[model samples]
Target: MRPNARFTDVQPIGLDAVAAAAGTDPDVLRLENLDTDVPPPPAAVAATTQALASGEGNSWLPLTGLPVLCEAVAGELRSRTGLDYDPSRQVVITSGGTSAVMPVLLATTEPGETVALTDPTYAGLLQRVRLSGARPHFLPLRVEGGHWRLDRDALTQVTTAAALLLMSPSMPSGVLLDRDDWAAVAETCARTGAYLIYDAAMERLVYDGHPRINPCQVEGLAERTITIGSVSKEYRMIGWRIGWIAGPVDLMDRIRMAVIYNTTVSSGFAQLGAAAALTDPSGSGVDEAAAEYQRRHDTVIDQLAGLPVVRAAGGWSCLVNATALGLTAPELSSRLLRYGRVAATPMTAWGGTIAPDYVRLVYSREPVERLSDLRYRFDTALTSG
Candidate 1:
């Protein structure tokens, strides 16, 4: 028997290749993974240890989530979005932010229905749409005045879509949609009856006074929006693999069924760690990490002057336009790895035909001091040709 035809056109080139290429090189600076070098908060670790020691986390938890974890997610959402959700019905934990996408798509959209996503989106999201058997349509974003702007005309096409997936502080570009754009998105989703899936994995990482806009705050959009967030980015707990999806109770009921069928439930111990992260009274760990990321963002922008790189307002990555280097993204990536000993993700991995001219550099993985060395190496590598 053969596999589903939906897997045919879904070839993904990811950062694993870059990591493998940079293997065992002491001088090689890894700028490929968006993972932070920061340690997980002490409290989070303690919480996980406690859960494991108590033996309570050994068995399966409620498919929705442990009550403490679910309550923590709802509380965090209320604090951020000024909206309250019932923990018992409105939130369900998943294996990770990435894992949450597939079930959401499966629960919301039927096979052959279209799911609209921004061009040059996260490659994993694109794969998820394909896995869900939904047609992937793109709403092209244009670089205008050194920022990524959503094309209004292209957005109109979203009206026919079964769902619209959006990532704030978008991957590769690091562009956060402004309030007006959020308003437009809300209007479109409300008018068209399309579900708005907001990927908020990096929501707390904004920089330079750029405010994070929650579409759920936009009046009619709350009921239709599903927010997927994780402790991976801000809490430095990527390996814990705990995330939550928050939305209307009815829709979340369907998502819970999907979760039950998929992984049964996320790690019970990991959920305890995530709960501690969200309820951290000091709030120093996440805040300090976000500040450090902002500093790295500024440092990279400053070091890469005169390059056609887009400025990152938030998130761990920004796109460098490699067209002037007279090489495709993959070719430039190879040269950088060979000569500069720097590993970066090529834009080819981001999917879509419009991304060939760029490479994604992640600032979060390296120390701020290492960024200067990365800059010098990149400069030497590009100019040597």
Candidate 2:
């Protein structure tokens, strides 16, 4: 039997391929992943262990999520965005941020509808839209004076689109959409009667003292926006596989149904751990982690100075213009893996026709001390070429 036609041409460039090219584990100073070197918070670990021992997490939970976890997520959302949501109705705990996307897409849009996305977006999102039998329309971002800005005019042109998937403090480019950007998107969505799917996987990692902004907080957009968040990046709990989706109650009901028909439910113990992580009295180590990432960001940008690299305003990764080094992103990535033993992801995998000349380097994987080594590797790779 043949697989689905949507997946026929979807060959993702994953970290394993990069690791193979480097002939080493992807974890070894390999900057291909956003994984941090830090361990999980003590509270999260203890909560999960306690849950497993008490047998509270051994069985399936409600498809919407456990009550405690839902409340924890709702409360966190209220604290962050000044938006109140009913724990029982507006929030659904998901397996991960990636897992949350498909259900939302399936629940909101019909087959063959156009789903808009920023060019150079997360590749996984592009595939998910296709898997849902929806078409994708990319709105290319413009780089001006080192900042990546949204093309509002282009977005407004797509008046017939059904939904828009946005990652603020977006991946790879790491450009955080400012308030005006959010307003433009909200206006466009409102005008077109389109939904806004906000992927906030890296929401809390903003650097250079910039405050985090949520599009849902904008006037009139709350009811039309579905916000997806996870503890993976902020709390350093990537392995937990816990995340959440929050939206208007009526739409959330459909999403809950989708979750039931999809994964059924997320891991109970992982939800417990995630709840503890979100509600931890000690602030969950998020601030310290954000500070650490900011340091890594500054260090990496400084080390890669003189290269055609745009400084990342937020998020864990930044884009390097590989053309300056006389190589395409994939070519530069392969050469870097072979000579420098550094595994950087080519932008071809991240999607968009505009990304061919760029490579994405994740600084979150290596510690501050190892940054010097990363710098040296870059020097050798570029000079020797």
TM-score per candidate, chains pooled: 0.96, 0.95
- List model 2 lDDT by residue over 23-77, tens digit each: 6554345788767786778899999999989988766758668999999999999
**CA lDDT, every prediction?**
0.84, 0.84
Residue 229 lDDT (model 1)? 93
Per-residue lDDT tens digits of candidate 1, residues 155-268? 866658888899988887787888888888888887788899999998878888788787787877888899999988878899999988999888888898998898888898
lDDT of 2 at 112: 88
Off by over 4 Å in 2: 1-3, 23-28
The candidate 2 region of ten consecutive residues with least summed lDDT is: 20-29
Per-residue lDDT for 155 in model 1?
A: 80
Q: Which stretches of candidate 1 lie over 4 Å from their true place?
A: 1-3
